[model samples]
Target: MTIKFRFHPEKAVEAAAILLKLHGKPMKYIGLLKMLYIADRLALKTMDQPITGDRYVSMDYGPVLRGVYDLIKGQPVDSALPLWSKYISPRDSNYVDLLQYPGNEELCEEEEMILKQVYETFGHLDPFLVEELCEEEEMILKQVYETFGHLDPFLVAEWTHDLPEWKDPHGSAIPILVEDVLRSMGKTEEEIEDISQEAQREAYLDGALPKIFG
Candidate 1:
């Protein structure tokens, strides 16, 4: 059986914003992507639902939220691209910068905590002397690359590659179904069945809402 969840773009952007804010500067887009994927995985394991509700795919870097990845690449995934772009800049030199604060209204307290914890584990930037860095203008980009290594994007990718749910796509993208993740998390057949049914119901409601209220 196929399982799908309606992607919530606001939550996705807010999650990214939260991470970028924690980093306090432009971050390697890859690092942001990895942290978002890890947060979703953790949420799935503990909360029984992914925080972003995004479609997942195993890519060369690791598992990624397909819609968010498209947004990062400046593809219009949906109306949410404007929302994402408003708070986050397009990819620049392999990095993305936060343009402004995007409030986490769609995220709950637990979700915020999870994102923060994920940042601490994988992307928290240490306090650095801005004035000292300003003096070394020529090394700014070099510093970013060096700092990013310490921020753990590559490390996170390697760790995620070790997950049972992650498959090496061999340079091609492979869909990572929610059922696949559930199974990897040791969810029972009955539980997966129930979750799939619930997802179907949610999708139906998502479709009917606009028609019903419009």
Candidate 2:
């Protein structure tokens, strides 16, 4: 019922609010879409769902987000489909178009500045690649990290002892399944990790796991 979407850095939250209020907000913002996915996979694993890391992937955000928004607006969450139960399966895209302009160019300079600052505050931005990530989905997981890091009073009080790596949104290790996604692509492990970390956030967020989308 309490759906914590993305890592809420003070600035990212403010900038995103501006982005949504600009004209109209999408059913879900892009970054939230990404985090929603990582959260889904983590939920599946924690519940001991009958699925392997290779199977339980994130759900499609566009339709899911729209559906949930309408459902939450009308009926209770329990009435809606168990999104996790259905979409929980293995996952692994062409996304060059999204990478042309990295980050949220939709934001104004002032807004952009704030979002970037928030990204840095997180220790790093979306560093994992869409294709090369392990089952961990580190990029999306970053949101959960940021949200708790920002909003959780416990985390705030224990900042020095709690390093970023010590946290995971789904309460498990990240599944950065590099070899599986790029196995056919023939990328080496090192190359894949580099790509996943350096890949632009926009394309990575918008793109789906290759196995599903392809």
Candidate 3:
């Protein structure tokens, strides 16, 4: 059975604040998004689940966390608008500021470690450079897709394989599923259940599960 992922807005707010703190200054919205994406990818690789559990999509620029991207843009869903407005800056500005610190109650130690690692690795880099890297990855996926067509074996490799929890939609705009991401990581059903349950519990404790899962 496929497991559907749910977004945790409280966690997203906390993650954004953590990135801002690591950045040590206001951050370009795009750059912040890139860092969050990298951290989520790292989490999926090591923990079998993403931090925010936001749906991902392969865009021309790179893979994006759909809900988090919207939140960054100040256009979050109705349920997320209050928390997003209280914490995140307007997206029209060149950079975003943390209005208040969202505590780390939503994050586990491992997730915090991955966020720190991602920031240390890529936070100082230019946002455009990060976007270019993502474009390059997309190019590779596109080439492989064209060469192999859409057969399951070839598509699986080209779309996921050793890649970071991303799937090429083969020219279509289908959103990648969390189930596919965990599968790409070779997580067993038990592992998936454990990760998902933990994430849900965290969100519930943070009061985000009701808003997202309702």
Candidate 4:
């Protein structure tokens, strides 16, 4: 009498097949991973996060571990978890180094000029980011404290939500994630694609021909 939120075995196999197709020539392990990561990120965007003792785990992990507990008998999962997991955890540097900022002290004019120059040069963005500052510079700066824990209050109103991001599960993260995988698979090197070029352009190109043919 054990129930689990696990994928159906046949379904899992088929899903793995689909992932293989999606991953193209990637190694089996890498392809499997991309499938899982993409699925988890998507699930996070659409579901309530699960409660797990001290910290809330992603809703994706919830299904990945449903049988462990009926747990307080069906209370709704908390919404705070997503904000914490997505915005706060990495900021604290307690977990995986997703996207991290040194700190958001107002960049000196020289620093600002440097960032503007570098960001403009390759059109790249903050490190450890899953998405882009796609919002207004004001909005992005406002969140900088939350993101980097030290943005100057004076600069809070600067970022607009218009920069850009990769699409779908990727949003701002698509380009980096794909490229990291590619690099790991020996497809490309860090020096090849200029970091100034936004990951969005690369991901868009990745999908174009397939979408066009489809």
lDDT to native, each model = 0.72, 0.28, 0.58, 0.24
Question: Model 3: clashing residue pairs?
Answer: none
Error of 2 at 127 (Å): 16
Best by lDDT: 1
Query: What is the TM-score of each predicted model, taking all chains together?
Result: 0.86, 0.20, 0.67, 0.20
Q: Number of clashes in every candidate structure? A: 0, 22, 0, 19
Off by over 4 Å in 4: 1-4, 47-214
1-214 per-residue lDDT for model 4 (tens digits): 1111222222222222222222222222221222223332222122211011111112311112221111112222343233223322222221122222222222222222222222222111121121211122212222222222222211211221111212332222222232332233343343324321433354456569788997
Q: Model 1, stretches more than 4 Å misplaced?
A: 125-150
RMSD of 3: 10.9
C-alpha lDDT of residue 30 in model 3: 59
Cα error, residue 83 of model 3, in Å, equals: 0.5
Model 3: how far is 85 from its true place, Å? 1.6
Residue 78 in model 4: shift from native, Å? 31
List ranges where model 3 is wrong by over 4 Å. 127-173, 188-214
Query: Considering summed lDDT, which 10 consecutive residues are worst modelled in model 1?
Result: 127-136
- Candidate order by lDDT, highest to lowest? 1, 3, 2, 4
Q: Give a tens-digit lDDT track for model 1, residues 1-214.
A: 6988878877777777767776878888888887777767766666677767899999987898899999999999879888888988999878898998755556665556666666666674431111111122212212222333245577877777888878899999999989989999899999888888888899999899999999
